[model samples]
Target: MSQLTTHILDTSAGIPAPGIAVTLFVLQEKEWLQLAAGITNSDGRVNNLWEEGSSLPHGLYKLHFDTQEYFERNFTASFFPFVEIAFYINSHAHYHVPLLLSPFAYSTYRGS
Candidate 1:
C-alpha cells in the first residue's frame, strides 16, 4: 500500500488493464519531478507508488498512464497516445485514482 495508489479498467474489454506503465510526478519549483513509477499488476492496481505511511508534501501531482503500448499490445488503434491526470494532494489522507479506459477514450476520477 502507498499514500497514493491507482488502478485501471479496460472498459472495452471489461477487464483489468494489466501491464500498463504508470508514473507519478510532483510539481517542483518550476518543473515536474519524478516521484515514482510502476507497472500495473494482474488486478490493474499499482499500490506501491510511494512508501506506505510516508509523508507526501502537499502539492500538485500528476499520474501519466502509458496508453499507446497497452493498445499496441492488444493490437488496437487508440486515439490518445497517453493519458495524464493532474490532481492536488493537500492532506495525509489516502488518494486513489482510477482510470476507465478504452481504445479511443478514457475517463478518470478520485477513488476511495
Candidate 2:
C-alpha cells in the first residue's frame, strides 16, 4: 500500500466528489515540485499518490484539488476555484489527507 492517500467529500451533495483533478507536490527549497497526479475515482480516492513500500524524505508537501471544474461539471456555483493543502511529513508514517468540501467552503485535517 502507498504511504500517502487522499479523498474528497462534497458536503453539499453528500457524496464523493469524483472526477476532479489532483496534483501532489513536494517543496524543495522554494519551489514546489510535482510528484504525481490523479483524478478522484467514484469513491473520491487516490491511493497511489506515492509508490508503495517506499519512503518519502521528510519535507513539506501539498495537494492541489481542482474544485471549479468539479462544480462546473455539476452545474453549481463555487466560491473557491481550487484548494491547496500544505502539510509537513516528518516521519515514515502513513498519511491520509481528506477534504471535506462544500461549494462555499472547505476544510481538511491530517487524517490517519
Residue-level lDDT tens digits of model 1 in 1-112: 6889999999999999999999999999979999899999999999998998796899999999998999999999999999999999999999999999999889998999
lDDT at residue 83 of model 2 (Cα atoms): 99
The residue pairs that clash in candidate 2, if any, are none
Off by over 4 Å in 2: none
Candidate 2 local lDDT, 41-111, one digit each (tens): 99999888899999889999999999999999999998999999999999999999999999999999988
Model 2: worst 10 consecutive residues (lDDT sum): 47-56
Clash counts for all predictions: 0, 0
Assess every candidate by TM-score: 0.97, 0.98
With a 3 Å backbone cut-off (N, CA, C), the pairs that clash in candidate 1 are none
Off by over 4 Å in 1: none
